[model samples]
Target chain A: MSSKHIVVIPGDGIGAEITAEALRVSQSAAKKCGFSFTHESKQAGGAAIDAYGVPLPEDTIEACRKADGVLLGAVGGPKWDNVAPELRAEKAILGLRKSLGLYANLRPIKVFPALAAQSPLKPEIVSEVDILIVRELNGGIYYGARQEAVIVNEVEQAWDREGYSRPEIERILRLACRSAIGRKGKVTSVDKANVLATSRLWRKVANEVAADFTQVEINHMYVDNCAMQLVLNPGSFDVLVTGNLFGDILSDEAAVLSGSIGLLPSASLGDGTGLYEPIHGSAPDIAGLGLANPLGTILSAAMMFRYSLGSEQVAAMIEAAVDQVLADGYRTPDIYQQGLTKVSTEEMGQQVINRLK
Target chain B: MSSKHIVVIPGDGIGAEITAEALRVSQSAAKKCGFSFTHESKQAGGAAIDAYGVPLPEDTIEACRKADGVLLGAVGGPKWDNVAPELRAEKAILGLRKSLGLYANLRPIKVFPALAAQSPLKPEIVSEVDILIVRELNGGIYYGARQEAVIVNEVEQAWDREGYSRPEIERILRLACRSAIGRKGKVTSVDKANVLATSRLWRKVANEVAADFTQVEINHMYVDNCAMQLVLNPGSFDVLVTGNLFGDILSDEAAVLSGSIGLLPSASLGDGTGLYEPIHGSAPDIAGLGLANPLGTILSAAMMFRYSLGSEQVAAMIEAAVDQVLADGYRTPDIYQQGLTKVSTEEMGQQVINRLK
Candidate 1:
């Protein structure tokens, strides 16, 4: 038996409602697998602003530091739109990522068989697709040298640099290789290597990293062609590793393939404690209505088990429970279909817990 | 009647055959509309390399500068893949765009009612979609400062700068507004404002440019969200404008929306002279055969009439005739369905010319 300590930050809006169900499901899974789980809830984003007048509180970071892993629901809303730039809810995410050194973000995209009918693509094109995009989260153009709104000779110009050190490329590529160790053992490094110097460097370092894992097959694709292939034939890709700029766009493009963005989970990992979260944002419009989908947060907890707690069997059990529930036609308001059993956020959580093997 | 002198560079492979059909259609349209048409053929790409050992010759640039506009068929093939990088087919495009000052790249994506079934997207989502992407061609990371493969401390690094001058942003936004003026008068400026300094500056300058054209409805979208929306709801957009790097990705993503990529045409415009070309590459395997699709080049000719020759009526006539031919079930090898009447490249061109109003 194993014991795990986790920090849960349900930041604003529907985050709390959906997060509650994830926690409940996690507890049930822990009991079924003979593992011990402990968690403490914390406030950030708008909730922190309302109470402590700051987007990220020191205590929240402190708790995360002391924990083995962190699970965040969602953050930001219309209420924090006009807040001072420094106190904005979105900053909480940037702050946490920076503070925790979360350099690699893992976004796994899969198309459930039962849910294939809901996809925008023809069923045959998207019926079987599983791709994990490993993005270098905390570096690249986003953190590079930048000049915004500078006037020279009364003319305004803007510039941003895209740079990647050897270590940054190595770390993310290594994480992707580790992910490949669990999957089909194929990695496609996407970049515009022929053009951008950063992408060229990215490709070189990726190849160097690939040399370390001889069992894993690695190839390269340009960012633009990767975008096209995602729609043309999504199943061909296994693991896609890229720098921040290209990953930000490609990951989002891959997310929409399933038409189940509300039910997808993501994990951000570093050399330290990792963070897991749903890919969807905080839907403040439906905060207290119980209409939010809990499956994403629930799946995030599953990812937490596999990546953070090192329990692959437990994670598979949780995911199979979800697949079973979805196959059985029980859905929340977000993924509701005609004749399917409709459940509230809490009810969906309970259903998954009940189905846990 | 105004006389338009243009240069036609039928680069390599199937380019010569496709260019012949487009020119024949252009001449028929000119005769029907009482406008004078004249063109000079020039060597470029593989053709120029075979003839003069250079991809883009100085004489060709001089001829293009003397013409009112330029029309180029597809360029590049595996035949030139091993040639010196500087003597490659791609340089011909770059050289022409730079020499002609073609800064605005216009890519129009439309889902033909007849071909909606061919889209990867379900018919309801992709049908009736018409979007125009106005991309600034001459600026941003593609033209930025670049450092490739610098080794330090026994590690390799690379960097690229994304810089946007005020005038570059203003010119592209102004062109987008002008495009909007001819369409629905709505423009969605895409950028990564939250992360990249260039995007933030792009947004700021775009807003300043928007104020001048008060009647045009302009909005902003991040590059990632724009990628999602391209698949989720392509019909909701009209005109999308952005910098070179973002445009390169987004435009290609948008290109695949219609699933009839072989039939799409693109235009690059500037103050001096505009260039029109088929978005498809030269297919050497199908070169000199009667099987290649010529509609993209024909439509490119139509764009030349409107954007370069200042003959919107001729352009509309050409487009409607192509629509008529397609609706009548005439198909080329690229777009042929089981029951449609199959036609060769020249026959399809003739059918459209016969249907011209």
Candidate 2:
């Protein structure tokens, strides 16, 4: 049996609770697939900032670097609200993404058949909604320069710089196109090319690289229209590629369209090891109350299996288990109903594991 | 009876077709309301570009400036695909916005109970979907500079700049706040304040302005999370105030949630004269086919009456006519299905006009 080492980061709030659930589910799937997995727990985010005075400890990064894969529960909470925004819990996640050179943030929006009613959109419109939004994670305006609040003639002066380099745009675009080719053989490169010059470059590069994927149908939609189309007709899209700023907004919109943010998993990958996490943030209000949904975290574990550990069968088994659990009417509070039984984080994890058996 | 000069610039593609419908409906509504509106036809957009080699002609701008109100059908088409992007037909519309100082772009997303079935979201989720998205039209990353593809050592280089000033942020925020005060009295300011300095300033200024609206509940949401929330729980939002970039993307999304982009209208107001236009672009593909949906353009006419002419009653009459028409089960091809009464552009216009009587 092949053995893979995975780093588990239970950052803050519901992080610790969901991290345990994901690990338990992963262990069961790994054993069934004839693989042995070793888990190393580490402190990062708000928890690390509290314990080590640094959001991301040096030792934690080193351990993650040496690991075959990483599974994160969630990060940030009001507990870190008093902390300087830069040294806040989110900084650790951003730092990991930057240091790991995790250029592509792949968020898959899938409307599982069982939870389709939870979507705010018409059931017919979102029933089988499946879209992969490849967002450029580490670049664009997120890391751009700052001018905080400037006082000119007693009035505040505020400015922020938004700039992007060629290499940054190209790499994200190439990865998005390659991912698109692997799926529906179609790619829609979105940008505000008419007004933004950076978007024009994005348009040009996307077209240039699209030529490389002759088998894939390459299309372009303005970022504004793309947002509208996602609500109007989501099924028309398969793979979406865009700049970092746009990806951040569009992917979140796509996530909610999938019915529950708690049901989606995301993978941020680059030059080093992959970091798998749920698209949803840690809900401090619901943390440790057993009310937090762990399905997103478990799904992240499945992604780690398929992408990092090279265990497609194990990943599929884990996915089937999740579907079966939902099909059997087990619901988390976030998606709970009166008649349908609501299960806690631990119970949901156990239910999936039992179904896997 | 007071007579208002209304500039009707039916730019290109189905713009001309739709504007003709708007003229008939507006003239009929004006007559019924005992008001007189002199409609002046002018050329703009791709049609203007083709005939006069200029998207925004001096005469056209002058007509809009002199008129009491301006009603645009739609602009832009692929016919000018090879043309310099700036000189394209869309620029005339954008240029009109800049010249007119149209800063606040108000897009209302209202799901009609009659056509709710056309929405992809479950009818229950979309039934009462009514939101007003106040987009800052003039500033943000939209006007940012860009250095197109550059070659250095056989490698390409590209850079785009996104910059915003304090006053620009303050003015737009104030406009958004004032607009919110009239509606459901809730303002959700969306920005990237945590990451970008411009957002920090935007947040600071918006907070200060929000303090003035004592009755309105003001909340802040990041642009990404705001987009997701828009889909996840549509009812939670009433009026959303966002920057130019976020507004451009979100307004389109909100429009589609209502079932048809064909039923949307937008108004852009700045320091000078306001411009009203349909959110749907000129569909040259359906140009002479008479298949264009004119409701958006007609609704734009209603917005013109309310904002520029300051006649909310006339606007309400037009809106009521529209609502009743939909209630009567009249559907255009874009929204029509079997068993529904389908109407053409002219028939739809006449139907609304007849209802006004």
Candidate 3:
């Protein structure tokens, strides 16, 4: 079998520290499982903005495009807050996405049975909750034609264009349905169709896509109701598909339901290679403290294995290894309980690797 | 004193039945307080759409405008799902808001001690939760200038103008801050200023307005993080103020944490009279079954007294009556526990009135 090449972009602050351990863990897992892996490191985000005069260097984007899979640590820090919007750390991620045409953002929120009590929701209600949010990333108000006038002459009017093409909506729905078919055979398309015309098109195209997936059950819910249901009856959802803005809000809430963003991983993909990353941002405050949680980054590697490399067995083994480590009481400071010992990022990585062995 | 005139718009489905009981309860309270209430009935929503060509009849709007306050008994039903968007039942509620210029939509979510165990959140987490959400309604994407393609085969691009004038943002923030000072003495302004230019203007104006109210501590949170924090640690919040769309989602989620939307009430106010209503939609499915919860509507009447008519004492009396009735172990089907006695909508309303006497 050909060796899989992975591009690692540990963008800023804690990102740099965490990505090292994530790579170490991945390397150890591949060795234990008898698979060949090759990894290379690149710089992006705030650090890139400082060094190369651009947050997303052309070479970095080219490297990501050519790699079989990409693993990214978190990005952005207050140190770079003064940077212009396009040149900021977050813009690098957005630039990579647009340049690579990465439209589908997949986020899985699951309540691990062992840690269910940590949920804000009652244990009985949240124990079995597992939801996959498929967000369309390339379109919506985020990338709309936005104009803002800050001058103190007349009243300032800021307008954001929210438009979606039939093809964009159709492709996203099709991708979501296929993902649903692979899991629980159910999908809930969320939109504000009751108000917005873009949502009307979204609902229409989603219905047409649903007709193609005869075996999968498709449902529609207004975005507001879906947000409520996510809180009150989280177990009822399987796969939720929505646009960029709603997805941003819903996914963040869903991430916290698991009790820690450190345990959540995400993937961004479209027609080409997938980019995997943890959902948490870089913590410049605790960068050198060695206290950053590395599990999210590790799990992102697991997603990269499955989605980019198409190695289901390898991915499952990586997941099982992490689960076993957690089940054995390895706790990072963020998720550390009353009696468990708090472990550093490198130690956590070592513990997971030991479990894999 | 002139008898306060309340225009009642019991729009459709269970609206009429529930509003009748809520009115009876309010009248009983008014009699005991040595005040009088005069109720004027009007047609609106889907029923109005069927009887008259318009969802909000001009006569109904005029009647509500002339009254001291308007009491809406929920709107929308599946019977009007196929109707044109403008003629839909929700249009009536929206029309009322725009016609009345009801810019501030205030929804208070509290997990009453009596209903603590009914919450989906852990009892320990939500036992003392009380939060107020002030949503800007008259402006933003909901009522913004929306341009849609009139015909197909054109480069169909739609744009929604989300404009909030300096004055509009300041007035709402000032009102919200004052309410916060009256209760928790803290205010959190939620926005997406990190992305949306309109939100930056909101942030700037809200900060400026907050300076005038030094007694109230003011802070800001991004909308997505705010949504997550609401679920993770709801008790940490006091009064949250946000734009129209974000407020709609967060308030709905907050409603869910109270366990049943059946017991929550809301108020929409601006330049003219305030509009009081329950947080629930007209449930056509359970209509005429006597299962609809009337507490929300009754509580809405209390909000009408406090916000519109400035009758704080009357509002407190209504709230006290509700507390006493719930303390007596009476439960609606939605909040029914194994051992509690289940009461119908009218029966529950009567119990509240009797307890007040």
Steric collisions counted per model: 0, 12, 0
lDDT per residue as tens, model 2, A191-297: 88777776777788788878887777889999988988888778889889887888988987888877788989999988778999998898998888999899999
Which DockQ values do the candidates obtain, in the order shown?
0.81, 0.63, 0.62
iRMSD, per candidate, in listed order: 1.1, 2.1, 1.7
As for candidate 3, its clashing pairs are none
- Which of candidates 1 and 3 is the stronger one according to TM-score? 1
User: Lowest summed lDDT over 10 consecutive residues: which window, candidate 2 chain B?
Assistant: B155-164
Q: What CAPRI class is candidate 3?
A: medium
Can you tell me the DockQ of model 2? 0.63
Instruction: Tell me the docking grade of candidate 2.
Output: medium
List the global CA lDDT of all models: 0.91, 0.84, 0.86
lDDT of 3 by residue, A288-333 (tens): 7889999899888888887888776677777888888887887888
Which predicted model would earn the best TM-score? 1
lDDT of candidate 1 over B299-355, digit per residue (tens): 999999998899998899999999899899999988999999999999998998899
Best by lDDT: 1
User: How many angstroms is residue B42 displaced in model 1 relative to the true structure, after the best TM-score fit?
Assistant: 0.8
Off by over 4 Å in 1: B152-155
lDDT of model 2 at position A243: 79
Better of 2 and 3 by lDDT: 3
What are the fnat scores of the candidates, in the order listed?
Answer: 0.84, 0.80, 0.62
